[model samples]
Target: MGVVLAGGAGSRVGGADKGLLPLNGRPLVEHVVARLRPQCDRLLIVANRGLDDYADHAPAVHDETEGHAGPLAGLVAAFGFLACNRQALPRWLLTVPVDCPDPPRDLALRLHAALAADATACCAFARRTGKPQPLFAMYRVDDDPVEWRASARDALHEHGSAWRWHAALEAIGVGFDAPGDAFHNLNTPSDVDEYERAHAAS
Candidate 1:
């Protein structure tokens, strides 16, 4: 299953819903969905607001915790949605933040391979130029999701950092040879404008 983490507070982006913000004439989440769809069997979007808008792209699920807890909460929400719907747990849960308009095209393939090769790794995340990106990760889902969900919730309650939680999971980092700007995040309005201008010019 593929999940888009769009439930951020957007504190740096003038409180705007970054996922719903326009980039290249389309919502940021739309661009992410288009890139992730073909890589997975099913897609889900985790958003705190604009559910209807996000739903237009894929089945949108709200965060389990309120007040934009963070991406860890979004992970919990994804697991909860699957449990609530009685859906079979996918072998791997692939996730990417919505603000990252362009992620590695072979994200899932590389992460899956890394996890498959490492018997001790509970998950695998992308690392660009030695910088770990926990948001763009693939979590191994065991036969029962209870343990995984519990650990995620614990991490969410203790510390809201995705990297911290991923560390506890012994996640492997799969390096990508993509450009340094491949995972450029649109955190502020200026970032969005700059990206638009750069891409439009190219």
Candidate 2:
């Protein structure tokens, strides 16, 4: 399963929904869905607002946790939705933030390989230049959905950082030898403009 976290407050971008922000003549979420759709058997979007608009692209879910808690809240919501609907659960979940319009094409392949390499690792995320991109990650879901749900709740209440939650899962960072802007995420209008300029140049 692939989940796009579009339920953020977008505080950095003046509270505007980053996913709906225009980028290169299309909404940022459109680019993200385009990149992620091919990588998963099923794709879902988690958005607090614009549910109707997002639904046009893919099925959308709202964060179960209140106050737009974070990506973990989105994960919890997705877990619940899958539990109630799917006859069988997916083995893993690949998550990416809507702000990151251009995740690597081989994201699932590399992160899945990382978890396979480590028998005990429950999560794996993208790493570039030694920086962990926790949002672009693959989490072990087949092992114990209940356990992961509890862990996500604990993380949401105790420490809301995705990086910290993945750490608790004994996550591994899969290195990607890609350009510096490979994981670039739009946080502000300037970032949007910069990415658009780069995209046009490319």
Candidate 3:
């Protein structure tokens, strides 16, 4: 399944909901969903607020547990939801932050191939600068359910950073080639400005 992490509080953007933020006249989440729809049989949206607004766009909506635990919380909730519904879980989950509009089109296919290349590997996308984009990654979900949930809880209680999620799973890095820099995310008003300039130029 493909999950869009739209539950963030967007504090970096002065409390604005980055997913709802408009980019080129459409909600950021809309762009993300459109990009990922072709890659998955089902779409699950993980949002903390305004989930109803996206109901028409995403097939289902899920929220994090109380205390604003963050993206890992969303993932855990998604896993539980799938388990409860008895849905056929995909081998890997393609996760993308709602704010990132131009994620690689072949993300799901590439990550699947990359993981298959190595027996013990998770795959994450990286910028040319070599910074790992944790949110834009595929995680192995079929292996150990107990350990995955425990690690998620620990990350929530301790720091709410998904870095632990990366550490728990053996991850490999995939890089985006040049001219695809439009994948830059909008975290603030200035970022929106930059996106506008760059998108308009394209």
On lDDT, the leading prediction is: 1
- lDDT at residue 144 of model 3 (Cα atoms): 55
In the range 1-202, model 2's lDDT, one tens digit per residue, is 8999999999998898889888888888999999998899889999888898898878998888667788989888877777676576899899999998889999999999988888788889999989999999998888467777777888988988999987878789999987767798889899989888877898
Question: Sorted by TM-score, highest first, which candidate order results?
Answer: 1, 2, 3
Candidate 1 residue 59 C-alpha distance from true site, Å = 0.3
How well is each residue in 87-188 modelled by candidate 1, as lDDT tens digits? 566878999999998888899999999989987888999998899989999988866567777788899999988899878777888888897557888899
Ordering by lDDT:
1, 2, 3
Cα deviation at 35, candidate 2, in Å, is 0.5
- Please identify which of the two predictions, 2 or 3, would achieve the higher TM-score against the true structure: 2
Candidate with top TM-score is 1
Cα deviation in Å at residue 104, candidate 3? 0.8
Q: Give each model's whole-structure lDDT.
A: 0.88, 0.87, 0.75
User: Candidate 2: where is the Cα deviation over 4 Å?
Assistant: none
- Candidate 2 residue-pair clash tally: 0
Cα lDDT of model 3 by residue, 110-182, tens digit: 7777778887675554444666777877877775545556766777777777765676565677776635554
Candidate 1: what lDDT?
0.88
